[model samples]
Target chain A: MNINFTLNKKSVTIDVDPMKRLLDILREDFRLLGTKESCGEGECGACTVLLDGKPVTSCLVNAVHIDGKEVMTSEGIAKEPIGKLLIDCFDETNAVQCGFCFPGFLVTSYHYVKTDGEKNLNKIKKALSGNICRCTGYQKIFESVMLACERKPLMNANER
Target chain B: MLDINCQYKSVEVSGKKEINMKFYKPKSLLELFETSEKIEGKKYFLAGGTDINVQIKNGMIKDEPIIFLNHLTELKNILQSDNHIIIGALTSFSEILESELLKNKLPFFQNSLKNFASPLIQTTATIGGNIANGSPTADIVPLLLILDAKLKLFSKSKLREVPISEFYLGYKKFILKRNEIIGAVLIPENAETGYETFYKKIGSRKALYIAKLAIAGLKKISNNKIEEIKLAVGSLNEYPRRLFKVEEYLKNKLVNEIDFADVEHFLQKEITPITDLRSDKEYRYRVCINLIRTFLNQ
Candidate 1:
């Protein structure tokens, strides 16, 4: 089946099984390896991606569901202003350890900071609970997201 | 093990057999029924695809026709009537959290939604799927039961309403027909009226832990007397069930007049807890009594 969807900012079509996991299609078919798959199940948000502007586990999402929807993986997030600011903050806070789970954290944190941006530490922790990090004990990750939200100006929906 | 004998069919797409299984995304209810009538082989209704995807990958499910309900606008509505609210079957937990209609009315449902799998899974896990999946540990089922929710099951020929309490037949079993799909959940508008409710899930940790033993209760005290009480517990038996005996014992009694020690012994007979991966039978039996005592004291 031919699946037509927007990746990053470009519209593209690919011939693949509709039941194929979006994580596999992105990493293998599109060669966009930014999205990682750790548990394969939805437990770990290592394969997190923005589906129609909401963060979801791509490992559980079917490619058929993305027929006309827009998918923003970690690869395309850096181009956005919020994504760049988050990356910079992560670097300054030493948030990225082994970097295996960095992309998922980046994508999930990007959506969290963009939409909620609650300065409360507990709220931020709850928002990012889906994504797991083994290297950083989450204090630095929370600090990184907090720093990014404080340093960057509040973005409009159009900016996201 | 799945018998993949006649289930595998090679579909020619773009001059090649690119797809292994057929996938249907229905745009409307009429289209969904039409497609349902035409399909000859096994069919699985895909909602959220959270549980179905894992089952398909793990070889626990066989190769079957999938009917995707994500595009049907009729099944995605959260409508409110004067006396009741109808939540569509495809409504996700994320949507449930954000719904003003549900937030103002049914906060216990929202409380259960918070303890559901995770934010990632909640974004895609639908209430319909949670009920249809028939897992004994489904966090939302017990709450729905306590809310006195009813499910609207739709077939190509007719539609029928079944109370959520009577929907489950046994372990991982529901009374739904093969051709039927859940349309919407009908919850009474005054289900929470004058009732103080509590929902608790004792899990290993907060985020992704499946409930060792979960409890949902709705209690109303009038003049220091227990006027009405409804209790449902899950993950302690073959299926989640309402505690009729306990509910009856507590009703119409003064809150402080009842002894909790005898009540715990009576409640133990209501459940058949078994040793499982999540917890031991003895622990489940003990925590349930403690939870009930705590809930009543609250």
Candidate 2:
């Protein structure tokens, strides 16, 4: 089956099984390795990606679903201004440890900052609740998002 | 014979781990029914692919044709009729949560489902899939049962509407016929008016956790008497069901006069909780009783 879609702001097409997972398609076909697959199941957010501006577990999404849809992996998000700002905040706060789950966190947090961008701790906690991190106790991760939320307006102004 | 207009492709991924499956994307609902009627053997309707994808990866689903239905935009809508809100079967939970009509009219229903399976799953998980899966722990079932929702079952031959409460025959067994798909869920507008609504989903942590047991209730008290009441529980029985007998017993009775012991006995008869991986039967049963008591007593 041939599926055509916008991948990371680029229009691309692939010939693969429609049943093939979006996660596998990104990694194997496109070599977008930033999207990790910790749990082949949707339980873990390690495979999270933006499907038409909404965060979805790429592991659960099929190749057919992505046809004519916009998909932004962590790799694509990293190039955006908000994504860069989130990375800087995480770096400054030392939020990452093993970094295995950082890509998923980056995508989810990047979404929250881009959409809601609230500095409230409870909202940040709720927004990133799907992503799991066994290290750093999540305090620094929360701080990093909160810090990014606080600086998002300034970053946007600079971008303008 | 399958519709000639329907497009389908059979593909086998060549590798160490190979999967051979035929995929069909029907252009219209009529085409879906026509193509489905001609297919022999196992096939699945892929709507959000949240549950089906996991089942496939776990090797629970293989060698089955997956009919893609997510792209059927005609079935993805939230419209308000004169007396009801018709939610398309393919409408995702996230879409439901975002609907201003649902939020304004069925605030309790919308708010209670906020903690359902994390934000990520909610983005792609459809309400119809949840009910059709027919799991005892399906969070949406108990709420829908309490809302007195009706399912519009669609088929090529005819379309029929059935109350959700009567749709389930047994565990994972539904009255839905083969080739008939759930088209829309019709929820009566202002169904919760003049009643106090309560919903509680007991899970391990919160987000991304399956419900061990859940209870939804709507009680209308007038002049210190229970005017009307509807109650439903999930993960405590073979399927989520209304406590009809208990509701019958409590109607027109004074709240304070009702005996707690008798109510517990009635509840015990309706629900059959079992020990499972996520919860113990004893805990589920006891928590259900306590939650019911709390809902009524308050």
Candidate 3:
């Protein structure tokens, strides 16, 4: 089956099995290996990716189902200004340890921050509850998101 | 974040012929019904694909003749009339959680929606899938049961409305025919107001965990007497069920006059709990009784 959709910001057309997972297609077909596949099941957010601007477990998403949709992975986030701010915050808070879970955490935090997530600690915790980070016990990751939310967008400064 | 040493397998089940599976995306309910009739071999109606994807990967279901219903615009809408609010079966939990109609009307259901899997899963898991999956631990089933919801099952030519209470026959079983698909769910307008409702989900964690034991109740008290009461409990039995015996016991009884011990004994007799990986029989029974007590007291 051929799937035509946007990967990150770019349109892509590829032929693959209709039942192949979006996670495997992103990694194997497109060579966008940044999105990790930790738990083959949807339990782990390691396979998290933005499907039509909503974070979903890529491992569970069928490539055929994503036809005519948009998918944004961690690689796409890193290319954006907000994504860069998230990375810096994660670094400053020392949230990046083993780094196995960093992409999922970063993608989830980016989606949360971009979607006007409340700065309230509890709300932030709840918003990021889907993504699990074994390292740093989540406190540092929460701190990173909080710190990221505090920073003004570099793009906004240019407008000012 | 483990190494990329994982082996990627085709979506085809082993020993099954790897024929190119045809995918059908129907635009309208009529088209869907017509398409379903023309299709041959095993057919699956795909909506959110959250549960079905997992089922396919686990090889619990074969991967062929999938008719994707997510594209059906008619099936993705929510319509409210004077007597009822009709929710399309493909309506996802995220949509339900964000629906102003649901929040303003059925707040208990909206609150129950919050306790479902997670933002990711909620974005993809449809209410139809939850009911169609017929899992004992389905988060939405108990609440729907108490609300007296009805399901509209559409076949090639006709539609049949079945009260949710009678929809489930047993574990992972439903009265739905193989050729029929759930079209929409109808909630009475009264489900929105004039009733005290309670929902409690005991899960392994706050999110992304299946319900260990869950309960939902709705009651109308008039002049210190119970006018009506509906109760549904899940995860402890083969299927979530409305406790008709309990509802009968509470009818016309004064709220303050009921005995907790007697109600607990009655509840124990109503539900048969089995020890499973999520919880043990004794624990489920005790916690369920406590939940019932809490609902009554509140």
Per-model TM-score (chain A alone): 0.94, 0.96, 0.94
Find the candidate with the highest DockQ and give its number.
Answer: 2
Candidate 1 per-residue lDDT, tens place, B115-165, comes to: 688888888889899888888888888888889999999988899999898
What share of the reference contacts survives in each candidate?
0.61, 0.70, 0.48
lDDT value for model 2: 0.87
Q: Which candidate number has the best lDDT?
A: 2
lDDT for every model? 0.83, 0.87, 0.82
Clashing residue pairs in candidate 1 are none
DockQ versus reference, model 2: 0.59
Candidate 3 lDDT by residue in tens digits, A1-160:
5679999999999876666789889898889888997766788799899999988888778865798999999999998888888899899889888998889988888888888745668878877778887767889999889887777443485421
lDDT of 2 by residue, B1-298 (tens): 1112222222223324455566678889999998888788878898998888777766777767778899998889999999999999999999999999998898999998898888888999999999988888999999999999999999999999999999999988999888899999999998887789999988888578889999999999888889889999999888999999889888898888988788878887777776789889899888987887788789
Model 2: residues >4 Å from true position, as ranges?
A: A158-160, B1-16
For residues B1-298, what per-residue lDDT tens digits would candidate 3 score against the true structure? 0001112254443443443456666666777777777777777877788888787767777546777777666778777977888899989898898898887778778887786888878888889989988788888988989888999999887889999999989898889886798889999967848888888888878777888898989888778888989899989889999998888887898878998777877777778887888889999988987887777777
Question: What digit string (tens of lDDT, one per residue) describes model 2 on residues A34-82?
Answer: 9988876788799999999988899889887898999999999999999
Candidate 3 deviant stretches above 4 angstroms: A153-160, B1-8, B11-23, B26-28, B38-42, B222-224
DockQ of each: 0.55, 0.59, 0.49
Q: Write down the TM-score of every candidate.
A: 0.92, 0.95, 0.92
